[model samples]
Target: MASRRHGDYWQHVLDLVFLIGVTFKAIDGLGEILIGIPLLFITPAGVTNAVHHLTARELAEDPHDLIANLLVHGVNHLAGSDLRLLGIYFLVHGIVKAAIVIAIIIGAIRVYPWAIGALTALTIFQIVELALHPTISVALLTVLDIIIIALTWREWREHRSLRDTARETWRWLRPAPARS
Candidate 1:
């Protein structure tokens, strides 16, 4: 049916986003781990000094001052331990998200609940981060997560319905056994 095809089309699109998300998360995790670790060597004062220099240099060129200021502010606030902890969080979260996405892609119905739980947790975390840090990107990511949750729920229901229908049909189609 056309509706089934429509669902299939959306499913494929979501799967593609998952594939892309896996890559994005992997890159973001690496960025956090690699960049944040090195940044730990510097004290907050040192970060402040760097931000001052960064602002000076960025101002000399034609670039977005808002970006420079945001980066400076972020670096100014975080301590060494905070950076390391965030780095570790990103790496672990990335790995888990990728694994779940892959499982879902392979039609692992069992992972749907887990994926939903993990995504819900992540969305909550993002909301908290938005409260604390208040970035546009964080807000956008939250919105995207909400959309993904809806799509995932729809897909899960469709898959379950199809599975139940198949089982019922199989039972009905099977030949009746002879009575003893």
Candidate 2:
């Protein structure tokens, strides 16, 4: 009984962690969609102008504001084609991620393998991007993906175990046949 209680406690903790991770990923997907919509509609010059306008007050207040300057510099360099491509990329990425999350939340066991596969592929792409860019944010995102992948694998295993146990119990409870 003590062992069972302990196991339940850890299971609850793991479930909570999984929930939090999923929530964050959902929010991230939404953010990507929001950004993508604007990129799709706006021209590169318009984006640069908007970023400058948004950052103007901050830059005035602090001439050395790193984020404002970075945003300005990044938008200034993007071409219209680049913005369009990026917009499409984010839109598709966000939609797929949102769909996967919904499937997993709805308790579709079959989706688990596909979800893991998709995430693994994305992680691999991110890793390649990180190699090229070497950004801190990208590195952190890669680490987060690895952690979520592990947690997801754990949940998958737990669900399979429960399913197997139920099958065994049903077999044991079934009536045996009698010979004539």
Model 1 TM-score relative to the real fold: 0.62
Worst 10 residues of 1 by lDDT: 1-10
Give one digit per residue, the lDDT tens place, for model 2 in 16-105: 566667777788778888888887878988988899999999999999999999999899899999988989988877887787788776
Compared with the true structure, all predictions reach lDDT values of: 0.64, 0.76
Error of 2 at 158 (Å): 1.1
- Return the TM-score for each candidate structure: 0.62, 0.82
TM-score of 2: 0.82
Segments of candidate 1 deviating more than 4 angstroms: 1-57, 160-180
Each candidate's number of clashing pairs is 0, 0
**Residue-level lDDT tens digits of model 1 in 1-180:** 113342354445554554455445545545545555555465677777877786878866846688887777677677767766765666556656666666665667777778778888888988999999897888987887777666566656666432333344344446789899
Please report how far candidate 1 places residue 69 from its true position, in Å: 2.0
